[model samples]
Each structure stands twice: as C-alpha cells, then as structure tokens.
Target: MSRVSNMVAEFVATFPTTLRPGVLYVSGAYSTAAHLCCCGCGHEVITPLSRAQWVLTFDGTVSLRPSIGNWTLPCRSHYFIDSGSIRWARRYSEPEIEANREHDRQLLADARIDTPGGRHPLIQYCRSVWRRLRRL
Candidate 1:
C-alpha cells in the first residue's frame, strides 16, 4: 500500500494548497485622510481606508475584483484581508507590522509633498505585489 500512502500524503498536502488564500501580499503602505481609527485598544494612527482584492486561483484566473470585491482597512489600526472578508490588527507580529507601519510612513512622506520619485515608487511597489500574486 506504499503507493496508496504516497497518494494520500500528496492529497493531504494539496488540500490546503487548494484552499490557500489567493492573496500573496498586501501593501499596507498607503496614506489617507481617515487615519484615526479606534484600535480595539483605543488608539489610532493614519492608516489606509481600504484596498482592492485580487484573487489568484490554482486554475489560472486572476480576479481583480471578485464577487466579494476588495477588502477594507478598519482604520490605520487594522489589516484588511480578502477584500474585507477578514479584518485583523492584532493577528500580526508587532515587529513585522512595525516595518509595514514604517513603510507606510515613508510612502506617505513620498506621496505627500511629491518627493523625489513621487508616487511612482508606491505604484511600482503595488505593481510588484500584483506580479508576485500572479505567480502564485
């Protein structure tokens, strides 16, 4: 039954792959006027309002705006996922999210006063994210 066992193992591994969320990465590095959002902890910061959702499937279909549409950023205090399907803020590690926070700050700084490269850098970054998502 070695063959059977191998097949079962493969199937089990592929199961989660089939259900894996198509979103590869999201850029939480944007700025908007709606920054002050009540963190469940009662604090707030300048965070993105929401973001579009792109769904990549194992079947080779990239849905930019799926039936569910894009996700929502619950203020600058939470991370929106699956195009508003899921909202999370405390789910991520403090350190890693700090990096996202810094990145967002830099993006705002660049986008604000039309710094050097201007918004081109932010667009490039989002484009890079799109490309990476397509690969999966």
Candidate 2:
C-alpha cells in the first residue's frame, strides 16, 4: 500500500547506492532530496531544493515544498510531504499536467540560474528527466 505514510528524514552528503522506501534522504550539500516513490512503485523520486523548485523546511519534522506528482509513473501518485506525513493530493488530467509542467519550465527559464553555470539548468534538468523516462 502507498500508505507507508510517514517518512523518516536522513541527512546525507549525497544519495546512497540504493534507495529505501519511507525514507526521505536529504542532501544539504546538494540541496536535494531523494526517496522511493511514495506510491510504493519503487521508482525513485528526486526533488531539487530551491526557491524556484522544492524548498526544505525543518520545524519539528521535515517537509518538502509543494507537492510531488509522479505523473509519468504508472501509479501517477500525487502527494505532499508535510511534517513527515504523506498527504495525498488529487490526480490531475493530462492537460493539467502538461500545463503545470510548462509553467514550471517557464519558472526555471525565468530564474536564469544557469547563466553562471554556462548551460541552461532547465535544459539539463529536462534532459536528465528525458533519459530517466526513456529507461522507464
């Protein structure tokens, strides 16, 4: 069941060779988080930490900003990580997904966080996502 619900936060300098379910591994050095999909599909989910993307919050428990929508995954799991709990969100239509994706791309493009890095970060991110999907 995707109801494996609560996730334990483990701070790491980088991701480990294998991912375990119900554990949100956070890398402060990389400003990223990774975990097996909350839907129990075993697919890995990586959320980049940034103002333009997901932000990490640590009050009592850890939380990731926004929601995670695994639309490409077979389960299409959608949920929020709030204070270590998985709060499932409603599923979106294909059109809504595309619109949201495009909007996110626009946000990255607008940020121009890549100018200093030479290549467009959005492009690199999209390419990495494409490669991952291709494997899927």
Across 19-60, the per-residue lDDT of candidate 2 in tens digits comes to 988999876656678999988888999998765688767665
Backbone clash numbers for all candidates listed: 3, 0
Cα error, candidate 2, residue 133 (Å): 34
Question: What does candidate 1's lDDT look like per residue over 1-136, in tens digits?
Answer: 0100000001111112122222222232331212122233322222232232122222232212222211134333334333223333354456766765576567566566664545454455545554565566
**CA deviation > 4 Å runs, candidate 1:** 1-84, 87-90, 115-136
Clashing pairs in 1: 70-83, 71-83, 71-84
Candidate 2 residue-wise lDDT at 110: 64
| Position 34, candidate 1: lDDT | 20
For candidate 1, the per-residue lDDT at 28 reads 23
What local lDDT does model 1 show for residue 131? 59
In candidate 2, stretches whose alpha carbon ends up further than 4 angstroms from where it belongs are 113-136
For each candidate, what is the lDDT?
0.31, 0.79
lDDT of 2: 0.79
